[model samples]
Target chain A: MKGKLNLNFLFALALLATAAVLPLFLQRTSGGKYNMIVLTYAMIWAVAASSLNLVLGYTGQACLAHGAFVGIGAYSIAIMVERVGINYWLALPLTCLLTAFVGFLIGLPSFRTRGPYFAIVTLCFNVIVYATFENWTWLSGGYAGQPITLPAALSGRLARYYFVLAFLVITLLVVRQIVKSIVGASFLSILSNEGLSEAVGISAFRYKLLSFTVSCFFAGLAGALFATASGRVDSSITSYLHSFYVLIYVLIGGVATLAGPVLGAVGLYFLLDRIKGLGEFRYVGFGVLLILIIVFFPRGLVGGLNQLRDWARERRSARSPGEEVAG
Target chain B: MSFFVNQVIIGIQLGSQYMMMALGLTLIFGILDISHFAHGHIYMVGAYLLYIFSVLLGINYWLALPLCMAALALAGVLVERLVYRPLRGTPSINTFIAAIGLLLAIETLVRGIKKDAVRVPVPVDRSVSVLGMSLEVQRIIVILGALVILLLLQWFIQRTRLGIAIEAMAQDREGASLVGINVNRISALTFAIASALAGVAAVLMAPLGSITPEMGNLLILKAFVIVVIGGLGSIKGAIAGGYILGIIEALGVAYISSTYKDVFAFALLIIILAVKPTGLFGERTAS
Candidate 1:
């Protein structure tokens, strides 16, 4: 089992490396600016969705304040670059740390609560954050959102694409490692049965806080990247609807697996952009798609695919006579 | 003293509206164990229904109120039967997504019909003076109407058979079924009652605020706060929480920055959640 898992891991890594290089090769040959732009947005969303999955899927905590964290990161980064004249690279870490601190503060109190109750608390937090961003004109530039300018060095779509792509790769690997670590096991145990986890010496409070903080950090990082990518900032970007969009992306792709969010982000983005004559109906279409996916494919797209693979393997094993299969 | 009294009155009036909306949400959460995200949209639908009856159909506002309520009640029953019933036994996330979809669809449909700019007109005259503070007649009417409805609901839930069945189901679904309570019928009725109340709230609230497709977003957030602060499934809690929120907002706006009124409710929510997770009046239950 461990050997097969290692092989699968290496294969997945090789595939990702190859895919990452393919874009550069394509850019060299075709110079597809639009494709690169879309891919960058997909990477940003993938980061956001992966962060949400840490709490929602792994810890069984539904946080609706994700977009608020994104806003915090974006606004923070925007202010650092635009107002304080800080280097973009220097501002990014500060944004992540500040967002993580805010997440810890929010999670500390609410983590003690049960499921839907915690969700409501987070919902309230989102609203408050949005309201603050809108009303606090002095800090957040009010409803207009502070204007941000990307560095001239990374102004082009392709450069922004590579920046976001690299960020996504780093965050994804960090999340993947966390999910495989002992801390990840604790999160799963806490999610599965909080009381049982407590009985088994797993401090539910500690792990919940850890996962929540880590999730918010990534969301904040994504927000910073998103701000840089858009080269514009607005309070509207931090609205509850944005948080809902991220949640939809995570759930639609497959919450349990690492690759689910990336697939979800790419698929939904393309679906929204490619669907013809359905300009304003994008939300309606997305909503219906979300409902269908949740009701039928509870484990999500990746889970569904895994079930198919399992079925095929079983059939092959049943048909084969003397094929030695390692247990 | 007079200023304080005026603030109290204003708070109570606003609280009544919040109570009306939160009551339905809390009941549905309690009875069905599902968070109905579309409740606010249903309230929006109620306002639209009032506009249709009062303006388009040329009916009087008073006559149109109950008519709209009845219609929305029926719509709620249909939604419960068709949309919610089919997805029974699914995880809470499924229902949550469904509710979001339903809300989006309803809002989109309303926008499609009204071109995203429909506003319900306020049709009321006269002002009443209480303790030297003048208040609008519409505000008085809305508060009185809310109180009457709440009292009637209280009576029905306490004294009526269907209400008792709903209570039983809310307390324990499987146990209610074991005791011969028709779960489906009660759930449907709860939806009807909740929807009808939301309709009433819409009619009254539309006069004070503009009605739009996205109006429900803020209203639903407030209702959720009220329900959480009051107690997830407690009617009395909803009422108390609503009044508390309204009063806090009123005072917070008067004393603090007016722009930060919305933040007060959320700040209170965070404080309350941190200190008392079960809410002020809610009983803690293991999931």
Candidate 2:
């Protein structure tokens, strides 16, 4: 019972699997297909948000330039595949490499600042990357937006959905592994006390740079998937606002939990989208919710639920005489 | 020479505006250690409140300025007590995320109220020729108003007992608290002063251009750039950085491409931060 995460972990896994094949269950109506496509977008965002969680939640470093990295990935794919006529398959790996390299350059200097200083510096970087994307028409296709699509074999709607879902699975699994690994422990140690970690020879700088590059690699992957899945990459994708939304997902879903970003990305995405009359209230609501969540439950939805479960168990054990003590 | 002088006037005007924005950010960061990312949006809200009081309620523009400032002071205190106070002792990133959340909420709320941009009627609707360049009365007012407020702020921070306590708080929160300086009062006061300064900037600049909810977005980033360039919490640094940024932007636009007008400050930020992480005027502090 103490290792009770298994049940919820499996539950989150079920929900994600449902997102992948839900179209197969639903009639092949346009509405069904539309929902599937939205989920596909959410899946990509889940990957992006999870990447952020790897750095922000686990490592306790908030790299706010996440949206810029996503933009880099999107543009990498679009520029290579759309303009240079490179194969999509080839551009996929190239996009990841390019984004990781960029992340390394950024993280080297960025890790120099810590905590909120780091957050603001990264945010400034986001502003610069976005400005470049908006102003560099020759490369970014300008604000009019550049078109991109998957290979013909993967161009089918269901194929694109499955492709994004597959990547989300891969990101979550790898992130889980990293979180449970010795390197993951180092990230947490730094998060708790950087000076202490450094004093103990954990090399806080190297670990942070590693987490940042890894997260950025996934951000790029997600961006490339978004470009192909949505069939376009625009300055809109590069907007600093996108950074806030990605952070929002991780915060609301559950920071530090592997299932948190996935739950957050998919749950909040659908809730905001399905509620048609929400209009501007959606952002206002998300903002207020984000604040309230941080104030009340810094651990997020998953963390909140885990606390509730613990409380409920304690109450049950107190009330029942026949039950052995629950952990 | 005329072009250069005209550009200098524009730079001074812009420099004052940047000072208004950056000072608040620096003040908050110094005293409270939160970046207050929503400041640009708060400035936008202050503009909207000014619009509501002056245009919507038919109040005089000058009268509405103080009214807006007072209201935002109340708002700043409330936000401090509510949004930020609860998350104290948590990680700095928590507060930063909260700031982003608050920023989004405020921007969208204002957008919901009014999506289209509207011009605030210029209280001083005239121009003057200076150094062979036509300077509008409104532009001069913006510069003078900002400079006056900044000077007053400088005096208050340096001279007053409360201001000295505020400075002490900025320098050392724990030390200030231990010495019987009410950390809560100073924190709330710092936020109030910061928020009101932003309001003052917004009110002054509202007449110079059309106002929109999105106006604060770019301004906030530039303000952060200024704050970063000046050293995060240095008042003098913020002031210097503000003017330097404004002049660079004005001249860069005059001589270089306007398309990259926004990029100049950002480039300056990266370069300055790379060279001197302590900022040009920031003292060395532990990470």
Candidate 3:
């Protein structure tokens, strides 16, 4: 068993190492620069989606304000660097802390309701955030979009790629640690049976609040990285449609699994990018695909693959009587 | 004071449209227990269909209106049969996600067909002075037209057998089924009625301004706010909530700021959800 665990760990490490070095490899190939940019975007979105997973997947809460948190992070960096004269690096940590605090406050009222009601409140929060970004001309620069000035040292695409990659690693590690810890078990318990968990003396509100705050902190980090790489922030990032896009990533990739969000973000980003020429009809296919996925593969791609493997193994065992009895 | 009255009048006009949309939403929520996220897209379809029938096909507006409603009713039934009915026994969230997918699909279809805004020309472009305030004749027609439809809808619900059956199903699905209500048929009927209501809203609002694919997002959000305020699944609540939201929005835009008009509904929703999850007219246990 220990050997098997070691093998799994080794494989995961190998995958991570490949992912870490992928952008450098891409830069050498034809049209690699654009691919690198898209890859960086995927990684950044992966971080956000994973943070969203903390609420939607683990806690079984439908938090539609995730993009708003991302927006908050991006706008903070934009305002601080461009208007407040704070150093980009110095402003990031403060911005994340502020976002987490705001998330905690928002979660207080947002999580008070249950199910669809909660979904709407969070969605409303998303709208409010976007409205603030759009209407507050003095603060967010309104519809013109605010630009972030990355320091000369990290302005290069490759450098920014590595920069975002570092943050992605930290986010994934933190998420993995949380999911593997006692809090994660509580989260799953809450998700599996909320009323029973409460009966068993689990303070549902506290754990959920903790999850929301932590999720927002990381999402804010991802937002800062987004601003650093893109060098601009706009109200569109905070729009509820963006929130829906992030939710779709988590849903399509697989919910409740750590790798699902990453797979979904990267997969869908590239898929959409590849079909840019389709323009208006592009999302129509995705919409149908989303409905099909929800209906047939509620567990998402990873879950579907796991099921296929199990089916294959079962079939093999059935084909051999001796193996079947042993199994 | 006259400005306030004007805002109130404008609010009533906007509220009438909102009421139409929310009526369908509340009815769906009452019976199916699903929010039908794609309902807004159905409204968008109604607008586009109006544009096609009245503008492209050169059909009369009076003729186009009924045809649009009937088409939307058929579309609603198809959506219920094809998309929603299969996932009926699953978790409600699955249906919600499916609805979102449907919204995306329909919105993309419309956007792909016409990226630019499509305007529906009203027969009456003239304005009339009422109590020293100028109001568009088309606006008054839309308001009176929506009100008449709403009253007819109320009468139908109160006086007609099919409407009573729908209300019975909404109140208790299993019990109504035990009484031989034909649950499947009623489900389709409820969806049809709701979609037709949304169609009415779309047609009325289409002539008021430029119609765009993206309008569904704002319209749906407002309808949601109204549904929440009036209490989910309560027709009366939806109507009251619609007027409240419309007036507040009109006043907010007129007095406070036009740019932040959308913020009022969402902010109110948050407040309502936090303070009273059941809404003013909602039952404690239903949602």
Candidate 4:
């Protein structure tokens, strides 16, 4: 349970508390309708980033094809609902499973290579999937935007927001339960030392594939929610750079920490979207923020705050009557 | 028959450009153990710099070419020293993320300044007949330039003390340092040389296409495909991979649909990776 908390635990807990209160906080900002919209998408992206954390953070597998999995989920649900007349709810779960199956297939070849090669292979897979989505017009509808028709039960902005929020809660609970289990410990051991874990009978390939498939399961959920909630599906979601954005979210948040990805996804999405009204400067701002954070706080924002908290704790303890000051 | 020859020639020219980029990319990977994902963006900056020097300042193209290389070399050194050097020995993912961040910053900065895609006029616009083919002089220039640069690079890496130092550093960083090699100097020099190669590539590519901030994204992706196909850290493999990809692309475009030409490269990457995970020429180190 201690895992990486020695690095960013307390700050992550604080951030989780803020996430719990984010919905009510956003609802009060009713005047900023555009901010509400941004909040909705940010939450969707948070879900995506969190699923990525399952594979990337928890399992230490850099599965860069995540955006494609999300896109598959989006397309699967959209096509099933609009073209096949399946109920949206029924279509959503089915599509998520389909996405996971595809993820397992992708992971088979990708996991053969280690580390950076793994990243590159998965990246190529992302591009390949994007190409298919773009050229196969009948299947994906390409850039024209595949239309997503939501059920009446989840219509309107507030309803959609609540719907996405409910799923986010479920996703967090699922991830938390997994993280607390022995399976999670196996993942950590793999991260800390893959050879040792494998030598001790952990079957690295099977566990990695399982981690990837489960992560894709959540990614598909987020994608389906995004498609139905946003009213469209597009190949742009599967772009290789979309996976980079998810990486940015996970890395800028604390790696291996649950609350960190959510904080990063929400904070960064809001900053670049709402605050930077200037069209071009937003990316410059983003790049600078990423560089500064990675350079100064490689452990990300939670880690930075953890350092500050510990520094203050050190100061308080030093001032106590327990020891003499040398300097 | 003439059409096929032209496709091969086109492939060669494209391969020339890719060879330069992939060589730089592989060298950086060899030395720093960093992927340097922004290598293409550095090429993108070189194109813009060429435009600024030749088109804006009215400097002659030849003069602007060297200036672009020099400026980019300096930029590469600064990047190595200020940005990436600090991230050394950390989890490679941190460095990879930093490189991506640097790429995003470079591209956004260029976009903010220029706002529109621009083209540099070809320095040599005349067309000539070569073996029953009508060829643009600029194409010959690109081919010759890349060839000369390759030879010069080969000499530098093989003959010079600094170059040998670079080779040593690439082979084993700690061992090189232990043998009295200055790690910092080699890192900067490697960055400088690699970036200068990218600059040459940019100059050659600038006349052929429009220079946009986002141009680097696809170029980098293609270069990665080429690099992976050849093998990471193998110069010969990079060259072979470049030509192979170029020919496949040219032939695919000539025979198949141009719309999915890019997909072929991605598919090739997957196929090769599936078949040989360490790369075709790679005796990869298990890091």
Candidate 5:
């Protein structure tokens, strides 16, 4: 089983590497600016959604304040680079640290509350962040938000895309590592049985906080990247609505697996872009999609695929002896 | 002295509205163990229903108010039947997402119809002086309306058979069911009452301020805070939480910055969650 898992990991890594390079090669031939931009945004969302999956998907803790943490990261980087004249590269780590600290603070209180209560607390946190961002004009530039200037090395859309892609890859790898680690096992255990996990000497409180803080750190990192990518940081990006959007991405993609959020973010971004003309009706579509997906495909798109594969294996195993198997 | 008195009255008025909105949310949370995110949007819809009756149909605002409530009650039953009933034994998150989806769907539908520019008309006759301080007549009406509705709701919950069943179910769903209570019926009734209360609030609120498609977003957040701080399943907690939040908000806006007015309640929620997760009146239980 361990060897098979390692082989699967290697296969996934190769597939990702090939896909990453294929995009660059396609960019050269197709010259699809719009496509590239869409792809870039999708990748950014993928990072954010996956980070959320660390908490919501793996830990079974539903958070509605994710966009606020993203805002914190975005605003922090923008403020540092724009006003304090700090280098963007240097500011990224600082932003992540600060966001992680804030996440720890938020998580502490949320630990006591379960399910809906926890979600409401996170919702309140998001509102507070938004209110502060809009009111603390001196710090966040109020509703207008602060304009961001990209570093000299990363000026063009193509370059920015690659930069974002690189960040997404790194964040994915980090998440993958965490999920494969003992801490990840603990996280899964907590999600499965919080009481049993506690009884089994795994401190659910400590691990829950750890998962939350780590998730927030990456979410903040994505936010910082997003701020630079968009060239502006606004409270609108941190709105409760945006948080819901991210949640939608996580839910629709498949929360249990690592690649679920990636598929969801990329899929939903393009889906929305395609139906942009629907205007407000777009949300109606999105909402309906969420309900249908939850009611019927709770395992999500990726999880459903995994189930199919498992079912195929079972069928093959149950086949009569000496039956020829065709691949 | 008049200034202080005026602020107190305004605070109470705001508190009353908060209580009216929070009461339904509290009851739903207590009974269903689910957070109804669409409740605010329903309130928004109710206000728009009033807008249609009074503005378009040319009905009297007083008559339109009850009409709006009746419509919302119908909508509530539909939502409960279609949405809540399907996910009875599902995880709470499933219900939460469904509620969010419903909120998005409703808000989007309203926005599509109104082009997202619809605002509730402000009632005529802005300022009326009581003693030395002047206040908005609409504001006073809103306060009175909220208080009357809350009193009626409280009476219904305490005195009525359906209300008693709801209370019992809220206390212990399995136990209530074992005692011949129709859990599904009570759940539907709870949704109906909550939606109707929200409708009444919308009507009262419409005259006081302009209604926008997204207006309910902030109101919902504030209501959640009130419900949480009041102690999840406790009606008295909801009332106390609402008044406390309203007073704090008014005072915070007066002394601090108006832009940060919403932050006070949220900050309070976080503090309460951290220090005492069960809220002021909620009992702590291990799940």
Candidate 6:
């Protein structure tokens, strides 16, 4: 078990090392500043998707308000910097706190429902947030969109890319720690059998609230990163469809796995980017791909790859026995 | 007083459309336990079909209306058979994802076909003054049309053999199947009938607003609110919840603030969820 854990740690470290230097590699090779921008956006989405995985993937609650939480993060930063004149870096952590409070308020009422009902409540929250963002002109800049001025340190594309990459790593590590801790165990138990867990005195409501607040915090953090990286905050960020996109990212990457959301976010974003010229027709292709993935690869890409690996190992073991018999 | 009455009257008109959509959604959820997220897109297609048959093909409005419903009913059955049937018995979330996928695909397909919204040209553009009010003739027709369809549906469900079979299956799938009811046939029928209702709603509503591919997204959101407010699987709840929502939205828009019209439905939903998770009329095990 220790050896396996060490191997997993080493793999994660290697992946993180690669990610840390990825912007430099891209700057030297492709040399297109646009590539860094896209990569940074992908990393931001990766953080958001991973946060969603905490609730939808692990805790088994299909919270669709994730987009709203991210929006809150963005708007909070936008409001603080543009309106109240706070430092951008200081505003990010504050945004996370505000989002967590909002999550707590939503989660309290949402605990009364379950399954699809919970999903709908979250969706309603999404709409409510969108309406607020649209109408509260002073805070979110309404439909005109609020432009964010990145600090000089992050004004460059490579700096923003590395900055977002660092946050993505932080998000993954924080979520992984949570997933590996006692709280994650309780979350999984609640997900697997809520009634039984409640009956056994696990206090599903409290844990669910915890999961929701924590998820929103990370999602908000991602949003702040996105706002600075993209240099704008818009009402569209809070739209329910954005929530659906993040959900798709987590699902397609493989839920319940730390690596899945990152892979899914980057992979699918690039896929959409590749077909950007198609205009609205691109969404048709995307929708078709979503259906195909859900139908054929419900466990997601990582889950499918793991299954293949296990199958290959079994085949190898079976072949070794056959060779021994032949000998 | 007249202004308040006007809003109430208009609210009822809007509620009728929501009722039509919610009725179908509740029926499907009753039997299949799937939210049928694509129902709004189905309504969008039905309106498009109405546009095609009535405007493009030059069919009579009355004839085009029924044809649109019939076509959507067939489409609904195809959706069930081709997409949902194979997904039966899987985790409910898979079907939910599939429904969302269908929503995206269908909406995008329609958008690809026509990027711009089209106005539905109906025969009556006149409004009749009644009780110090000027209500659109088409709006009255939509209300009466919704009432007639809803009544016919009630009669069919309560009296017909196939309808009784559907109710039985909805009440107890295993028991109904054991009693020799064809479960697959009934499931398909439920989907068809529900989808047909959405189509009828589309025809009724086509005259009220310009038809757009993106309209279904908001329509579905409202329909979902109605379903949850009324109770997920309760027919009577759907009817009641639909009017409640419509009236609340209208009154709120008229009296409180117009900009917050959409927020009222969600606020009511959250309150209901917190106070009574099963819904105002829901009796089922919600989880």
Report, for every candidate in turn, its global Cα lDDT versus the true structure. Answer: 0.83, 0.87, 0.87, 0.84, 0.84, 0.86
lDDT at position B89, candidate 2: 93
Cand. 3 TM to true fold: 0.95
Where is the poorest 10-residue window by lDDT in model 1 chain B? B112-121
Per-prediction TM-score, chain A only?
0.91, 0.93, 0.93, 0.87, 0.92, 0.92
Off by over 4 Å in 5: A1-18, A22-31, A142-144, A320-327, B116-127, B285-287
- Superposed on all Cα atoms, model 3 deviates from the true structure by an RMSD in Å of 2.2
Cα lDDT of model 2 by residue, B138-192, tens digit: 7788889988998899899899999999989877889999999999999899999
TM-score of chain B of each: 0.94, 0.96, 0.97, 0.97, 0.93, 0.97
DockQ of each: 0.54, 0.65, 0.67, 0.52, 0.66, 0.72
lDDT tens digits by residue: candidate 4, B24-46: 98999888888888889999999
Clashes of each: 0, 0, 0, 0, 3, 0
* Per-residue lDDT of candidate 4, residues A181-294 (tens digit): 999888888777889999999998888888899999999998898897778898888777778788888889877877778889988898877656688777886787788888
For model 2, the DockQ equals 0.65
lDDT tens readout by residue for model 6, A250-317: 98899888889999999889788878887778777667777777788887898788778768857886
For residues A1-327, write the lDDT of model 5, one tens digit per residue.
Answer: 565478668977885786567566657755566778778888888889999999999989888888899889999999999999998889989999999999998899877777766787798889888877776788888768899888888788788888888898898889989999999999999999888999999999899899999999999988988987889988787777778988999999999688889889988998898889888898898898888888888888988887897788678767853432433
Q: How well does candidate 4 score on lDDT at residue A154?
A: 79
lDDT of 1 at B71: 92
**Candidate 4: where is the Cα deviation over 4 Å?**
A1-30, A307-327, B130-133, B285-287
lDDT of 3 by residue, B199-235 (tens): 8888888998998998888788789878877887888
lDDT of 2 by residue, A127-237 (tens): 888888788888788767898866788878788888888898888889989989999999999888989999999999999999999999999999999898888888889
Alpha-carbon TM-score of each model against the true structure: 0.93, 0.95, 0.95, 0.93, 0.94, 0.96
Best by lDDT: 2
Q: Under the 3 Å rule for N, CA and C atoms, how many clashes does model 5 have?
A: 3
**Regions more than 4 Å wrong, model 2:** A1-9, A310-327, B285-287
